[model samples]
Target: QITALDSDTNVHVYAASKWKTIELTSQMNVSTKTPYSNGIKFTWQQSYERGNQYCLAISAWRPFTSLCQARAADNYISGSTEATNHRRPAVVLMGCTDHHSYTLPERPHVIVHVAVWTRQGGPPLARAVVRPFKKPRVPRLQPGQLLTLEPSSGGRALARLRLRRGAKRLFVVAVACGANLKLQILSSDGSRVASVAGGQGALHLKLRQNQPSALKMVMTTNPPGAARTLLLAASTSAKGLPLPRLPRNTVVSTIKASCNNVTLQWKSASGNPNYCIMLQEDFNPGGHHIRALAQCDWEDVLQHPVGYLISQCNPGAMKARRQRYLVGHLLPAHAYIATILVQHPITRHVLALKPTYFKTKEDCSL
Candidate 1:
């Protein structure tokens, strides 16, 4: 029998003097070290019974191919299929998390899309990751620089685009060949700004920058497989050039910083009073290559839960000033970045404020 661990007494240990030498052969005395905690120690014991053997195997997967939230230990392989079924796909997402932090983790709804496909005689397609999409920080368009947009023909029933500029007028013109196409210009929070539904003819819509910094576009075509074209063109006037196109009181005016707390001050947003505060470590501002992966999230970067603090501005109303929030559980001698998410009280639209960062001193306490 095979015995391991010092406490195991399943088999008795033998001494060199107790061994019997073959008929006429001579045997030398052998001694081995006893098993201990530090290193692998083996003892030479003679027994007539054979026991089970133990072994280990190593595996290596493609970089970033491993899922962060695997429920169990199992190996999966993708075969030659153009697309995998979403209901029972090879990769399943559970949630986002930090690196095994002891604190409570935030559960963000991260939607997974795009399936990795395989071909018969061609090269394999690159894997695509699906993560929550954020609004891009686009600069204002220059004078005489016309913005043009043309949609693609695909199976998607809805498409989204964001336009960020301070300009005089924005226009969207759509030409439907024969299908019923619907166009909706929405605010950041999925609120409708301008909508048009029709059978044919050119639908022209205009928007201004002084209204909202960014807008979302949603297009739907009826009869499923009808052909359609959408053109988005924008222009700026010299009269509205000096001031930003966004409405007044749309962003936080200033941020008050302290040793262990921060106060975000802002003029009452014109339409909405609901707001949110989000904080995550911004140690690597210029390098965001790693975070582009769907698995990497605020928790992973912050080494803790995503400090997403949500609160209303005022009871029944939406106004709060000098809002002070205690920045707790921050690492000493570290830098962190914070941002604000405000929703329009009336239109139910949303907007994000400028991001700000602060550094903590040693032994910082709230």
Candidate 2:
């Protein structure tokens, strides 16, 4: 019987007195200290009529490896004839006497995550992660540099290389960069599967994603730097998704900023009903900072009892400046970044402008 003991039952007291002459038998109850330094005592009181015999075994069992409870296996053994089956055999020990443990061999499981980038593809190029179940280290991406088989879910991005499903897997080609960069691929467990080579061109890495795999990209920095973007794209439909229409007559004009407050001024396009101005600071040449300081918006043609201001330039149209709003305060000396965005009043199509730049006084800076 597994009896739970409290502090009142001194471990040393029971071992010193009642259990001093324990004659263990198969019928003798075995009391353990909860496998650690428990102060509780196990009173294996022996009856004079019964002989004592006990079978005590100390063994460890792992449903999953690691405290994270995420590792499927511990190593990458060569693929055997049974690679098709996902369940990798586990190593277990029997009759363990002293603190039993098991050492997992390399490549214990056959699960892999495959990231593919396709270009006029035949067979999808593959780069198997050298180490499975670990996070991959991603290097700083140059303006035009690309990596083969990048993992991403689709979204609007400038100069982004999209991945396509090839005959066997998805494929992506990295854009070439001239300088040496370091990249590491990690699996779910904190292990490295692949590392960057010293070549200027792009290198391909493959993962087998027959099953769902969760991975993250990590990079080491020489000099301190802010967080960079990691691309993850969702599968696009068979017929290509409609591309956003190119914006025309993109203009940059001045806006007003008082302390932390900002007011933007802009002219509407022929059929523009609503507009969005995304603000991002272009102070640093190597990086772009995105943060909204304030926004001004209004609908075309008065709809409700809300006080409406008509545009002087266009009849029956609401003025742009009349819709201005003060969002929140900015830090003193911080720059105010602005962009002009316009959308078709009826079509709801968005027209993004080239990012604009400005600065706030030190009193209103963040």
Candidate 3:
């Protein structure tokens, strides 16, 4: 039994040849004030067992209830792992704050639950440590500087990087060797700015002064191996390289229109460039529509696009020198605007071409 919200429960079982069962319960009074002011860290380690492995489950919650059924709500955080020969340790980090707003309370209390079991009915031997520690200082990053991050024992690394002031655009490049990497960039207020997952890639970001003056970089590697390294670099100018010229005199025309689909054809550019087609809902396609779309970031356009496609075209090999794209799964009788864009093969920068406006047919199914 557990009565207190702020308490640690550890269960241990000795190794045995045959199946056995043991149970223990304890209760404590709830404390009004939490002792762990900074944060709490949970660590579990187990010895290797040849025939069987231990499965561990750990969770933390707040605002305790009397009924045991109320513990199912993991409002704070939870983690689980299976202890095997390759992976022998499991760790969980919890902060003393509300999950919705992430704000620290004047007095905080939390309940930590840990459970362990084995498949073969063999006794599992494990140890758990729960302690509170002060927050660690995060290192800062500067522009035009390269930072190398070594993989941690827990397979994640986090750091804070500052953006250059008065720059209209910023580019971030990341490369990982011998491992898969997932990188996420967040603003100061915890809002996501950009995220990329691959072995190597670059992210383009539009900047406003003092809006998101600082960014947090979260990098994680697969397998939790020790030999992985992530190289990160930021710059205002893309290594003194100029962006590719936007495609000129591009034309788009509608070939067929239906209640839920639209077929369009556009003439390819002279140089046979790689391009992307985007469809967006437009209630007002006026003089300022193209200007507004041009000002939006590429990531912003992807959020609410009705249809999108990317491909390369070779005008020299085609008879009509026109590419066809079918935009489907649209609402009936809805107005939409289609825009063409040419993208750089290496840097991933995109420039908008001409846009065409059209509307879907009315619903005929009665």
Best by TM-score: 3
- The 10-residue segment of model 1 with minimum total lDDT is 115-124
- Give the number of the best model, judged by lDDT: 3
TM, every model: 0.27, 0.23, 0.30
Ranking of models by lDDT: 3, 1, 2
What lDDT tens digits, residue by residue, belong to model 2 across residues 235-270? 222111111122233345555665665765444433
Model 1 alpha-carbon drift over 4 Å, by segment? 1-256, 285-326, 346-349, 363-366
What are the RMSD figures for all models against the true structure? 25.6, 20.5, 19.8
**In model 2, what lDDT does residue 348 have?**
39
Predicted candidate 1 versus true structure: per-residue lDDT over 167-234, tens digit per residue: 44665544333345667777777777788765432244556545455566565655444544433323
Question: In model 3, which regions exceed 4 Å deviation?
Answer: 1-133, 200-211, 240-366
Between 2 and 3, whose lDDT is larger? 3
lDDT of 2: 0.32
Residue 101 displacement in candidate 1 (angstroms): 64
Candidate 1: give the clashing pairs: 209-245, 210-245, 272-344, 272-345
